[model samples]
Target chain A: MEHRPMIALVGNPNAGKSALFNALTGAHQKVGNYPGVTVERKLGRLALPDGRAADLIDLPGTYSLDAKSPDEQVTRNVVFGHQEGERRPDLIVIVVDAANLDNHLRFTLELIALGSPCIVALNMVDLATRDGLELDADQLSQDLGAPVIPTVAVRRRGLDDLKAAMVQGIPQHAAPLPVHSEHAAPDADELRRKAREIARRAIVAETPTRRITSQIDRVVLNPVAGPLILLALLFVIFQAVFAWSEAPIAMIEETFAALQTGVEAVLPEGFLRDLIVQGVINGVGSVVVFLPQILILFFFILMLEATGYMTRAAFLMDGLMARVGLSGRAFIPLLSSFACAIPGIMATRTISDPKDRLTTILIAPLMTCSARLPVYTLIIAAFIPSTSVWGGIGLQGLVLFALYVAGIFGAVVVAMLLRIGVIKGPGGSFLMELPKYQMPLLRDVIIGLWQRAWIFLRRAGTIIFVTTIILWLLLSFPKPPAGSDQSLVEYSAAGRIASVLEPVLRPIGFNHEIALALIPAMAAREVAVSALATANAIEESEDEDETARTLGERLQGRWSLPTALAFLAWFVFAPQCLSTIAVARRETNGWRWPLFMTAYLFALAWLGAGATYWTAVAFGL
Target chain B: MRLTSLEPNHPAYVESIDWNAMSEMDSRRLRELGLHEGASIELLHRAGFTGRGAYACRIGRMIVAMRAAHAGAISVRTGAE
Candidate 1:
């Protein structure tokens, strides 16, 4: 039996490590949970020299082996083969940032200390050269006693040399350099002395280029201008999301509408028609329609992240974050939560302190994910007039912006409360490295957007598919009263259940239509749109305008303004999506936080919605 | 002087670090930044309010931050004067 070697891909965060891994392994990858943790372990097989294959593991990105966060801990553990059930890597391929090698080397040196066979793939070499960097790869390799190959992972450079080096194997147990230890960590003074000495001897830079990054950072990171610029950037992103996505969203809506009509027409007008048109078509179509918006949001985020502006943004936000008892590192995950809470919660694994991680998880759902977009768009479209403000700024878009702002405020307040009340611990300080800015790689950005779209489609096909079918069954069963001409749904089990639940929700301004929407929204919040579409008996039409007209007409007389606002308020705090809850459970490793999250969120939602309803009614809106 | 009091553009040589007194996470973080004892660093930017104690400093080319409490633990001598 031929024994193939194992090669581990390691790098600092945002060093194009994943893109490189994807380039190397391409469709040969499997994602699994690491033993005893929810952090994803990505493994794939790649062909080595001599026509044999080697296993490749993409380790989580960390700055150094001095692990702070659980994800970093796992990376450290797995690299040193300290993790149970994980084999020691035969060769370690360190992915270093070509432009920012000074900091990247910290981790590289730590990896070297592990005494593993190693090679350095100087990634992002293109960016470094663009910035007028001259690296002596051979000299650096000789200095560190390792083979260093310059690579542009995004452009697929240096793969052959990297692979050849992997197959050739590195010198085993080379003299240990003075680097940070992986385990039995030395005292802080000793580590610093070693780091300084290593830097003094191994690293050298020619005349420092007065880079444009510092000039831009001067204004963007200015105390007064920084926050304003951040606000403006956020405003522009949301405005662009709403403005640019409208055309594509309309197109998707029209397509789905035509498909729904065709499905309804071909299938007999009975159970089969209902299931196909209402459950499968309407349910999946409603959620999938927002794909353009989700993709657009991710596109901008990936662009910002790739260009290295996000780290500076985090640096700018450090003070505010610390005030709320979170490190600056928490900003990335929280910002990601605005796109979707599940991944946002997962990203919190990067936070080192257990208290910070748990607090981040507890409040992540309040970040107004894209799932809430459908509900916000629906309510705002129905209630807020589509008038523009300040020369073509959509009033509806402003309201949508306000809703997002409210969610962020709520999350921060909750985080503050949790820090003081529940997870009473000293907030961890922020210490992050801001990488040099570069134009984002087009390939990586597109691939990132594609991955997000794939995740959304997958969710629609699986969780939303099954839940909608079950909901359709419950809502369509048991024929109406014998003497009545009402549709079966009017007297069905779902209708009865909604009516019974209506009294409890009445104080929150929810009628049977809104109450019925909640049942399906539990699976995924975006499913509420389809639930409402089905409940209102809006027939499938080929034209998007007609579908919008039908929905608007159905809701016009039935829902009061207060009720619409109240429903938005409800979702502002609603613990409706079980996927987020499941992620919270997995991340926390206990039922306690998720349960607490659900209970408190539900209570807050009820109170908030009820307060909005009564307050609006008192004003006689 | 404590590391926290260093003014912007002031260079400092780290004299000592009380690693045992610090949180394990903080110690690990400090090590990652190359800020262990004997490293010379410079305070680059102090953007946040003093009460909150958020500041950015550079050790070589890598910039990092810590709260006032943690920064107070590291002894340094300013080279500015």
Candidate 2:
């Protein structure tokens, strides 16, 4: 068997590299992480015209080989064969934005200087043509001493030519890689000058065409109207996440509920039945039900990213974010945190500065992710009345809105404090390119959404599934004495553990039941609701007489208003989700920051709960 | 005049850049984006409440956003000036 040639796709940011990679490789892509780094590794198989297949790796988008962030460092290391667990590519396909040739060609020139066999895919040729720029690929190929193929990656144009060029260019066997030191760091300024000259020579004709992007940016980035439009857009997204997802969420809930009921009927009245119904169905269902909201939030996020509007949103939010000592770049990640912090924390890779990224990671949990919704709604329904207050706002709606605002407010304060204390530094520079707007390909958007959904489901299947089984076993075994008056839950191991946890939680107005729920809730924050229902001995199925009253009524009958309020406050600051902590550890590359994050968040949760509990008691609520 | 002082939509040529005015990483970014002396540029948009937080400019067919502070480091010459 001849060795499969390894080909790499390299480009400056927004150079349409990924789209071209998707077009060439189609569905044969494997996404993973580089060992010891958070940068994503995308590998696919490129089928050659000749009966052979080559491995194609899509490296991260970068401006130059001169590394700044970890993401950029991965690209540089991989291209130079220094990256561990990655073989040196046999060929490099440099993707450059055709319209931005003068700027992109600078990086292309630097890559060419590496003395590696290279081909240039002049991407986004359609957009360039629309901008009334005509380019001669032959002249550009001659000027750079590399083959240039004009491609519109999103439209799958020129992919055949690009693939053919790749097959002919990539070596069959491993070639002795050039020493990265041999490049001696080509002067970037000189490369820019050379790139400009080459680009000028390649352009056969040009006309000053009006760009729709600038026209849109004029209104979108307007000092007066930009912020308003952004806020309105966010309002619509939040409304949609809750409103549009209602039907699907109900369907998911009913499906799981029915599954639990079916298991109870089919299985014998023993450990397996209890484990399947309560442990598997209820435990995972609590999290799986969040899928609709997550998908909805990600759809908008993916569209924003594809449409080239994410940067504009960031630009508009820069002013407000700056007030908190963060740049506009942090805005998108923080916004994503509203739907889920796991992705939000992952999104922080866009913040190149270490301090900026760290600070954003720490405060992301304060954004009130969708996981906390069930707990909040349960408590609010049980405690706050539905009567209108202050004209037409329902008191329940006001409380929910206040909780969201509280999270944002807490995030603001924590960000400022972190900037001044722990992660102190001059603010990171917010230098970004606002790419021209284009219609995102439907195929690309679907692929992106699928990847995000798969990641979320995998987490639910593995970590949440295992933790639920353990918690169920702890609650199920050592059956209460034959005539015992104690309920099964109160007689279990978890009940005994909750007794010890009760003392610590007492100051914050929590009872034995709340303590029992808090333990399993550590796996995922949404589990708090199911755990609470179990502690109260409330049947989870809908047909039971007790279940007819709903979890809200059960909570209302058992807990004081102050305790419910305190629980809400606790969740607002609590870093209770294990997955979030794990992701923070991965993204930061160590236990140090994630551990610090957990510690501070726990401290805040305790203090906030205590204060809210005491304040509610004082007010005689 | 500093690039930040250039009125929006006024095309200008970069006269000189005071790379010493900012962090080395930021200066590298500016240079990498072709914001050096002799590059033609036009201020396209100003964002934020004060309109001083971030500035958008066009350089070589790309629109780039940078904080006003970074823009203040480069000097530019409009035709009239």
Candidate 3:
């Protein structure tokens, strides 16, 4: 039996490791969860020139082997064969940024210290050359005592050479280098000195690129103009989300309406018919309608991240964060929250300081995640007038922007309070390496957006789908009294529960309809739209106007402008999603912080809603 | 002298690093600074808030951070001559 070697691909964050892996493995890749952790492990087999297959594992990106974060720790463990049941990699392929070899070499040296057979994949050579970088591949290879192959992972450049190098089995030579105390167990000074000496012999730069990046950075990264640019970018993105997604959203809505009508026409008027048409179709439709908006949000985020603007944005925001006693490193995790709070909360592990991590966890949920897009869209579409100002800033976009701003403000306030009250510690320093700007790989951007969309749909199909069905059953069963004109729902268990809860919610502007919606919204905020559709008997209607007219008429004389505003206000601060709470619990390592977060958000929502309602009544709007 | 006061382009030599005085993580970070006893470093650039400054310098093959306080500690021989 021929024994195949195991190969590991490693690089810095967003260094095209995945793209290279995909290029090499193509359709042979399988993605699975890493044992007990949620971190995804991508493994595949690549054919060697000799016709033998080698196993390839694409490890998570890490800055160095110091293992500051969980992702980094996992990478460290896997590469060193510390992970249980995992064989040590026969060869380590160090993916270096050809454009930014200075930063990339830090990891290279660290990996060299591990004494693994290694090859350097100089990725993004195209970008490096475009930026006027020159590299003598042979000289670099000779210097480092390893084969150096130039590769453009996005363009699939030098992949064959890389494969050939791997197949040839590059010799492992331990170069004399300085080992920092943090890296190994002993001889820190000696090791670091040796590492420097090796670097002096191996690495050579034609011209320093930092000066150019810094010169460009002065203008774009200026504190005053930088924030303005950031705000302008965000405003444009929000506007685009509403403008670009409108047609697709309308198409989805119409498709679902047509499907609902078809189902109602074919099935008999009974509980099963209603369950299929009104419950399942409507429930799933409500979630699906928000997909375009979610995709749009992700598209812009990926673009911004790809363009290398995110690091500058984080750098600009560092001063403000320091004022509130939070480190700038919290920016990435908090920004991730805009897509979903679960991963956002989980990403807080990057912060080495425990107190800073907790502070970041507390504020992450306030970053208007994609899940809240449906609630915001539903409320804004129903209440806010559709108009444009200053060329094409849509009114709906304006409202969405305001809601995002409100969430950000709420998060900052919460962070400030937490710093002063609970986890008080001196603010630590911020250190980050800003990479050179490069055009994002379309393949990676598309894959990222696809993964986000799939995750959203999966949640809807599983948790939201099951919860909606249960809710429909609860609101449909326990038939109404005979000879009574009341709908069957008025006598159902859900109706009784809402009626009992109505008194407590009435002062805050919640009617039975909204109250009923809230119960299912707890499962997922977007489900409230489906619940409202079911309760109003609007899902079975053939005409859009009939459904809209009935819902509008039912809510017409009952809800004042203040009541609608109050409802919007409530959702802005409402802790309605259970997944967020569960994630918060896991991130914080106890129920204490999640409980406090839920309580504060709930109280804030109620107070804000109550105040809006009363104030609207006073103004007679 | 604090690192915050180091003039851009000036060369500095680290005399010593008191790893025990810093937090474990901060100490680890200091070790990565390439300042382990007699390494020569230069301040390449500084842009951001003056109070909590963010600087960039080359250490081995990496451009790593040198906090204002840490930067100040390295005794420098000005290259202006």
Candidate 4:
């Protein structure tokens, strides 16, 4: 049996390398991390044309072998076989954009110089031809001394040719690209000139380019119109995410309620039954019910990125972000925080500046992720009336908008403080390539959404399920010694802890129930409502009519205006879920930043809640 | 003239890279993006409300943004509007 060889894909940024990897590996891809770093490692099993299988690795994009960013460093190390635990590739597939041939050829040439068995995948050839760009692949292959195959990665064109080329028996000592390494390492200028010289030999422009991308950019990148268009687009996405998910969210809640009822009816009312019904179903359900909203948010985000509009948004935000000691690249990661801080913190890997990236990570949890949505919605619906305030705007909706604003404002303030106080340094400059816009491919969008949904579901099933059970135990244990005349929950361990913490929590208008609920809430923000639901006996119901009461209504029966407002304020600066903190710890490579983040956020939360409580009470609300 | 001093809609040719004012990494990145000496550059827009930073420019065929501090490294000669 011949050993299955390892093949690698390398390319310049935005060269459609990832698209090519997805096309080549389809359905067999798995994502992991590089040893000792958080950079994603995407690998898949590749079935070669010659009936041989290969391990495919997708290296992060870079312009040259000279390592500038951390991502590029990893790619360099892995390619040179200097990275520990990563075997050098048996073959390399260099995916180059035919349209951006000149910019990509420099890196392509460097890879060829490494004396590895390499093939150049000239990706996006269809777009190049349509745009009247002419490139002779044979001429390029002749010039570079490597097989150059034209491919439209999105359409999966030329995979068979690429596969055949990859598995072709080529010695490691084959012809290398011209390199004069003894001449003090050719600078960027010398290397670029060499690349252009190679490009001039094989490339031709068929016409005076009338670029539709330029025409679109003229509007989208305009100083005046650009910001306006971006704002309007963002506004629509925000409104749609909230409005479109309402019915689906309600359906999820109703289904969970039914499940709880069905499960409780069969069991004979014991600890196990209570744990399964109230703890698992109702508790995990509360967290899972917010999935639709998260999905909607992610769907829009994936679409914006696919269409290449996200870069323009970042370009528009660069100045504002720079003023706060962040680069424009931080915008995407910060935006991801609006969905969940875990992924957002992970996304911070894209920011190259260590100080800027750390600051972004620390402030990410303040973005009011979807987990916080359930808490805000419950409080707002209970306290604020749904009656139209402005011409026809619902007051409850207005409160939700205000909460979102509070979270954004909180993030900015914290970032600014950190910028001046702790991580004081000049802001990193933003240099981004705004890729030409294209219609987003539906298949990719669907796949992206499915992955996010699976991740959210897995979290709800595992972490939320286990935490809810522990909470259930806390509220269920220390049995009441046969009719001593107190509720079973109050006699349990959690109630005792709540009673002890009541004095501290009471200043912010939280009662024993809210205080107790805060324990499980550490696992996820959405669990607080469920903890209260079971703690207050609201979960004790047999009929749909009884169980169908919105968590908001049940909450209103107990909380005062001041109390609810304080809770809202607390969420605005919430320290983040445990998972998020754990991610921060991992990302920062130590406990220092994560511990600092928790301390600062808890302080902010306490102060915000305290102020709101006192102010609302002073107004006699 | 300092590249930062170039006005919008005006074209200039980079004459020399006085990279002494910036870090080696920034200078190398600029070079990689084709901002070397003798490369043509056009100021497209100065970003933000007060136009403080992240200036938009056309270098060769690509549109890129950079801070004024980094822009200070490239000395340019006015070409045309």
The best candidate in terms of DockQ: 2
Query: A1-621, model 3: which lDDT tens digit per residue?
Result: 856678999987656788788778876766655664545678889998868788999998776776676677778778767766566677889887776554456667667666667898988887767655677778767756778899998788899999999987633433223233343543444555554554455445555545555566667666466667877987787678779988898898899888988987899899888888767888777777778877887788778777777766666667667778787678878877876776677767667677888889878878887667766666676777789978999998898888888888988888888888888777676666566666787877876777677777877788668877887889888888789787777678887888998997899878888888777777777776556766776644654445555665555556667877888788878854777887777666679989988888888888878988989889887
lDDT of 1 by residue, A1-621 (tens): 855677789988767788789888876777668877877788889997768888899998887666656677788877767777777677888888777665567667666766677898888887677666777787778766788888887788998888888877733443233233544554444444543454445445544666676667777667777778887988898778778988998888878878887887787888788788777887777778778877887888888888878877777777788788887778878877877887788778767777888888888899998888777777787788889999999999798778877788888889899999989977766667666676666876776677678777887798778877888888888777688876666677787888888999987789988888887788889777766776887765666456656676678679998998888888998955877887788888888999999998998899889998999999999
Error of 1 at A588 (Å): 1.9
Per-residue accuracy of model 4 over A1-621 as CA lDDT, tens digit each: 756687889998778887788888876877768888887888889988878788999999887777667788788877777677787777888988887777788888777776777899999887777667888899999999999999987898899888888878333343333333324345656668878788778776655375676678778878778889988987887788789988987788789878887887888988788788877887788788778877888898889888888877888888888767788888888888887898889888878778989999999998878888767766776788779986998888888889889988888888899999999987666776767677777777876788788877987888778877888888888878996777777788988888998898888888998888787788888777666666776645543234435566777777899999999998888747888888899899999999999999988998999999999999999
Q: After superposition, how far is residue A296 of candidate 4 from its true place, in Å?
A: 1.9
- The parts of candidate 4 lying over 4 Å away from their true place are A169-189, A261-269, A390-392, A540-557, B1-12, B78-81
Cα TM-score per model? 0.88, 0.97, 0.85, 0.92
DockQ of 3: 0.28
**Best-to-worst ranking by TM-score:** 2, 4, 1, 3
Native A-B interface contacts kept, per candidate: 0.45, 0.87, 0.15, 0.39
* Candidate 2 residue pairs that clash: none
- Per-residue error for A138 in candidate 1, Å, reads 4.7
lDDT of 2 by residue, A1-621 (tens): 868899999999999988998888887888888998889999999898877889999999999988777878998998889999999889999999999999899999989888888999999999999999999999999999999999999999998898899877876556556645634887877898999999999999999889888899989999989888988999999999999998998788778878887887899998788888889878888788898999999999999999999999998888778888898999999999999999999999899878888889999999999999888887887788889988998999899999999999999999999999989888888999999899998888877888888899999999999999998988876679999998888889999899999999999999999998888888888778877877777756653223534878978888999999999999999845889999999998899999999999999999999999999999998
RMSD of each: 4.0, 1.8, 4.6, 3.1
Off by over 4 Å in 1: A1-4, A12-16, A22-32, A63-68, A80-88, A97-110, A113-115, A122-143, A152-157, A170-199, A204-212, A383-401, A484-487, B18-21, B48-53
TM-score of chain B of 3: 0.63
- By DockQ, the candidates rank as 2, 4, 1, 3
lDDT values for all models:
0.76, 0.88, 0.72, 0.80
Show the colliding residue pairs in model 1: A192-B36
Number of the top-ranking candidate, with lDDT as the measure: 2
Off by over 4 Å in 2: A179-183, A543-549
